[model samples]
Target: MTDRREWPLYEVFVRGKRGLNHVHVGSLHAADSTMALRNARDVYTRRNEGVSIWVVPAAAITASSPDEKDPLFGPSADKVYRHPTFYPIPDDVPHM
Candidate 1:
């Protein structure tokens, strides 16, 4: 049998039946992607709450660090056009 310690870490994302996007659920160590996906489903969706599961190898993910948030995201703060504050919402708009 393969050693558990040799397994690679995986990040799990699960989409609930009522959710429109896949949310990061948790992480696990698995021998491969298939096993990671199965383990994620079993661990995170035991109650049948999730409709989809995605497992990505931890090393495969590249994320910005919180410490660098200002330098990375600060430029976007001055882009006022990105915000919809100037628009008036109509009553007929469902989610607005």
Candidate 2:
């Protein structure tokens, strides 16, 4: 006999505000895409904690491993010149 107890895994992304990018919160399982989305909303956004939510299949998620992280993100560590430290901003600047 075969067991029919498996469900698709979903990854959740939530945005804090209307104009912000969605940040990954967590993952869960559901039967279908629509159900997965609804489950995510209920699971991650119980208190209106986020303005938006995104759910994608966990299988679709592709990422570099820790061993590759150093080589992948290491370039940014040495590129201090790319930072705003060299750029002189007026004290009057609001967010800068």
Candidate 3:
């Protein structure tokens, strides 16, 4: 016997009108990719809050473990020059 719980799980991302990037919203289980997208829209955007939606199979995502954050991000921490703090913006720049 097959359990419905075995249905593929999908991760949902929503881009709100005010947001510049898509943000993780929630997860849902569906039989296929098309259904997953429709289900994500119906479930996560009930209030019409999102301008865009993305649905990816949970199994397709490769994520770093939370416990390994320091190890994963440590190299970038010492590269202070990577940040634009030293750059002087012209007054003409609107969003800087």
Give the best candidate by lDDT. 3
Q: Model-by-model lDDT, in order? A: 0.91, 0.88, 0.93
Per-residue lDDT of candidate 2, residues 1-96 (tens digit): 999988989999999866479898999999988999899888999987888788989999897899998889998998888877888889899896
A best-first ranking of the candidates according to their lDDT comes to 3, 1, 2
Candidate 3, residues 44-90, lDDT tens digits: the string is 99998899999999999998999999989988999999889998899
Model 3 weakest 10-residue run by lDDT: 1-10
TM-score of every prediction relative to native: 0.78, 0.79, 0.74
What TM-score does model 1 achieve against the real structure?
Answer: 0.78
Which residue segments of model 1 deviate by more than 4 Å?
1-4, 78-81, 90-94
- Better model by TM-score: candidate 1 vs candidate 2: 2
Best by TM-score: 2
Q: Per-residue lDDT for 1-96 in model 1, tens only?
A: 865467899999999989999999889988899999888978899998899998999999999999999999999999999888899999999995
After superposing candidate 3, which stretches have Cα over 4 Å from the reference? Answer: 1-5, 18-20
